[model samples]
Target: MHAQHDIVIVGGGLVGASLAIALENSGLDVAMVEAAPPGALPPVFDERNLSLAEASCHALQALKIWPLLQTASPIRRIHASRVGDFGRVSLDASEVGREAFGHVVIARDFGEALEKRLGDVASLTRYRPARFIDTQGLADGRREVRVADAEGEHRITTRLLVGADGMKSAVRSSLGIDATRHDYGQTLFVSRVRPQRPPDGTAWERLGPHGPTAFLPRFDRHYGVVHGVPSEEADAVAALDEAAWLARLQDAFGWRAGRFVASGERSRYPAVRVVAERLTAPRAVLLGNAAQSIHPIGAQGFNLGLRDALTLVEEITAHGLDDAAMLESYAARRSEDRARTLAFSDGMARASSNEGLAMRGLRSLGMAALANVPGLRAQVVAGGMGYRGDVPAMCRENAQ
Candidate 1:
């Protein structure tokens, strides 16, 4: 006899963990298979900085996870400009009738909070330090997942199997779902730095020939820096000493954020975009990076993934996992938001790095329009705060 669950979530990272937390006390048997051991941080919860959109914050709050994040920093304002360009745009949350557009959080800190919250989910069963071996379809239209832990392999049958395992998803592959990948040919470096003039509730994005150099506010009064460079130059740049790298950052970003007087450890990774050809297959579905791994530019990766999780929860609760039509409806509902976000991130990544005169001119004009037009600016602000498409109930303003 196999262990049984109404839902089995593969990957206990941010998105998967969030889903489990949202389903707490919902009268469903849930199981989570995580590769990390107890109290260990997953690779997704490393030193990276995440910018949580306002909608994501609301969803987290609804799931009772936001209050646990004591170190989150609110983003009250946004400043966007291109180096050597006369056009610049500044947006304030007050203009959009909100307290903030979102918050900036360290990935590891958020993960710790998620781990703590997961313990409170009464209906969740966890399989820690486990690897998802494979899955098989049952004659009754259900799925059986094989997870291997220290005690060896265990079989669990589920009405719905969720693939929140991220970029290289095993669940997606087992479902025979194809994904399209695009390499941006760029590398992003992330680190924390103390500047002469630290962040004051403002986030800055400075675009250059290479890519955007972003400085996000952090709770510890330090700026979380994300710098991008050409792939060929990543090694050379990484080899630079702290002082030299700080100097390079200052030169690239200008004195707007002030001089960097001190720095912390830095991590770097190649920027790539991967989008699954489809969102659902039979009794299984994908979320977060498994559905779409977008570029870090615009900071939409996690926010988009969180929305996916929340939306799926809504669908599952409304129709249950046994409803085949509910799965199709979930895919249809997510199509617009997913497509729009992917296009925006990919477009920004390419446009910001293109040195062509025409592209530069267009960027300048766009910035000018956004700066001078309140209606246009408000629309942009709304989208930036994750108000696109069919808004999930938890993400809505009146969501309790």
Candidate 2:
């Protein structure tokens, strides 16, 4: 029942799919196992808008996935501010030389684009909604996976095993890796709606005592809003009908751009941070949310995962996918990146989401400093774009 391949990735989410394509045409046989299918996928991006850095754009373009994501909207500018009962600090794109701080992509469109590209990849084998039977890695560094399909037991063995399964990753558990979990007790209410005025290619966030209200530009006239609040308070806030909820959001958010009213359906999800104790061991490695799921306050959860995926692809390509040295290098290379990003994101959520005058002052100071310091601003952009350090092969210019 065992089939042989060069790599076996568990989970076909965004990170895994992108990694598979990155490894394609490199003479490596990649078999992807997923617990779910892409059928009945969500229509439109709904309320999820991700800020993509220029480096991410490069990686996607190199992977040839960007061509399929034509519908994505560019964030020509980012307008950030801390809204206390007193003062505010704003950061405009003009602070940086780039026309926009980054681009904001709708997840639905992003997923659909990736799925379409996946269809054309001849090297990929997808097992949708497949039930895992068992997995064992031999002392020789070879790994085998067993799963139950309609026909029953089926197996595949590969040189490397990957866990891209997500927050509660089964692959992570199977590898006996424990994760450090943090429950913020906050729910994120998200949706796309028509606001009173155009965002003018600028992304805006108002930081109040309750939490930060971020508005990311989407389409011609629509915008995506992410409001973080306590779990108990979520039901009351999110439970309101669109009109009622919109009114509430407007009042809490106040008016910086102008006015915001009317919205589409609303969706809320609890916020949490999950970081695995280890990134790799022998033939096993974690990718995407399987490795770390940070707070969404900075819209970094999935964005950070994409960077990890791209880095893995680059390393594996350079030093052979099955090479133990390369695997260890991948783990070491990602450690600092993961640690720094997690700390920054987790800290932001903690600092900005809490009430108190001291926190408000600090938040405002940070924003103001970030606005005035050109070098610091560039560093932030580089960090966001996935090009901060030794450029991975895929992240480099014209990397296949």
Candidate 3:
């Protein structure tokens, strides 16, 4: 015999663990199974900072974590434009009637905070660094989670199973849902670099021959550099030392920011678009990257994953955790959003990164037009705000 829980959520990363917290005291016993060790949780924010949109701020606030995060710097303005052959167009925060579109938080701090919050949740139990040995459905609509941890093999049974494992979710494999994976053959190099001066309240990006290089302001005189380059060239650049790396950045990004200085070690990641064929099954649901993961071109991956977690929480709460309708509703709502964001993000990344002259001209023109069109701007803004239309009580309230 094994202890049973109402829901067994796999993966305790940002979205997954946050999902567990959101459901706290929701009259359900939630168990989170993570693949990372308990005491080995290292600082994760050293490498990258995440930009949280206005809607994301509001939603996270509802989870009782956003207020504490306000101490981190908020981006009051976003200076966006097309850097290719076409002329440039920009948008200011004031024009949209807001302080800033959102804010940024170091990745390590964000993860640590979420993990700490989970520990405080009275009803949530954590099984850190647990490996799944077997998971099969029972005849009574109950699912069993066979996990191996320090305690050895143990079973976790629940009426519903959640797969929030991430882009390479293992739960998805056990469920046998086909995944659609696309390799863009590009890599994102992320690190913190100092600019000529503290950025003047905005970020800069140069879309060029190799890839798009961006300078995101952190604070003081430092800016976070996110360079999207061909996978083939990523390693060679990442291996450079401080002075040499700074030179490479200058040549690739130009002197628009005055001067570039090395402040953080460079890290790289292969970019891809991963989608699960189905979001829901009989008594299971997938959230976050487990459902879908897309290129980071527009900073859409995390934003989209947050929506998936929030929406799933809403569906389960409204339709009963064990009801098939809950899973279906989550799938339907998310599929629409998942498809729209993925298409927009992947299509744009591909179009913007193309080396061909014809496509470049088209992308440049499209960028200029979108900037000039008021209606188009509003639509893009709303989408960026994570506007999903009639969101759940928790999400809707927080997105205020």
The lDDT of each candidate is 0.90, 0.75, 0.75
Highest lDDT, which number?
1
Model 2, CA-based lDDT: 0.75
For 172-263, candidate 1 gives per-residue lDDT tens digits of: 99989999999888899999999987689999999887888999999988999999999999999999999999998999998988789998
Better of 1 and 3 by lDDT: 1
Per-model TM against the reference = 0.97, 0.92, 0.94
Clashes of each: 0, 1, 3
Model 3: per-residue Cα lDDT over 1-400, one tens digit each? 3878888898877778778988886889998887888865523335676777677777788887875563356566555544556756465667888777666677776776776677779998888878766578764778888888887898888888889888888889888889999988888888888776777657566766445677776754678778877888777877777898888788877777788755677788788888899887777878888888888766777878888888877777789875667787777777767877888888877776677879877877877877788998887776766664544455566333
lDDT of 1: 0.90
Q: After best superposition, candidate 3 residue 324: deviation in angstroms? A: 1.7
With a 3 Å backbone cut-off (N, CA, C), the pairs that clash in candidate 1 are none
Instruction: Tell me how candidate 3 scores on lDDT.
Output: 0.75
